[model samples]
Target: MITLDNVSKKYQTRDKGWFTAVEPTSLHINQGEIFGLMGYSGAGKSTLLRLINLLERPDTGKVLIDNQDLTAMSEAQLRQARQNIGMVFQQFNLLSNRTVAENVAFPLEIAGWDAAKIAQRVQECLEIVDLTERAQHYPAQLSGGQKQRVGIARALAPNPKVILA
Candidate 1:
């Protein structure tokens, strides 16, 4: 379902100049399978994930999701394609200003879903993560696990096909 062809990422630093974060790595992730990228903290695992989501462009090679070359897509096209992908961060990046329900509805807002539809989806997602009762609570009010659950709900709000967490 996902293919990385000779992907490499490089970063330019002020003092260090250009450094290769990820080498020419080729990987394939099939449908209905679990894949793991294990390495040390600075081992480029997170960089690879960023490449998959197009949050960070690869220096060389290509990223293909379901056979569509994302590296060749336009900015608008890439944005649309990213709707099918969901991501959760290890830091649980929840909006402190919004309630749980509103946080879950943020992506739907960007996708131009109507109020009624967003409300319905947000409710369903909160219920899925067992946070329906806390829908009105802000992120600061929740524990670490609860905050992560809200993040998961927000990420899943768009009904994505691939989840990157």
Candidate 2:
């Protein structure tokens, strides 16, 4: 489960003013459920998603995933916790030098999975995203959509409990 308790975020503008990105809000997402946020540009959709994974720290409130408060975790603890929370970025942040398969295997590697296991999981995830044929290709070699698929495969490689895309 994911819970946001009166969460809010604000940023300081260049003019030394404040811009409220997210208003104080509370939300709950049960296990095995799919939830989406929708709005116009600059509507805090991205901010809200980033808050869930602590990519952007909340100015107020707590971010809890599977009953643990992410905001309270130490850096090392948070790094461990983040393994179970995958994120597919809008920009498809794949390593230009790494092949698709290697990119997908990246998370499993960070999680300390052995080579054989990582290989198997990477293949499975690539298949799921229908990027198996592009596995040996580098990010730069793939089209935009293919790059996005590689990002999806990478996110799924860890079999994360919560995925923010």
Off by over 4 Å in 2: none
Tell me the tens digit of each residue's lDDT in model 1 across 1-165: 899999999999999798889999998999877888899989998999999989999999999998989999999999999998889888888888999999999999999999999999999999999999999999999999999999899989999888888
The candidate 2 region of ten consecutive residues with least summed lDDT is 131-140
Off by more than 4 A, model 1 = none
Best by lDDT: 2
The model with the greatest TM-score is 2
The lDDT of each candidate is: 0.93, 0.93
Cα deviation of 53, candidate 2, in Å: 0.6
TM-score (all chains, Cα) for each model: 0.94, 0.98
Q: Number of clashing pairs, model 1? A: 0
Clashes of each: 0, 0
Q: In candidate 1, what residue range of length 10 has the lowest lDDT sum? A: 28-37
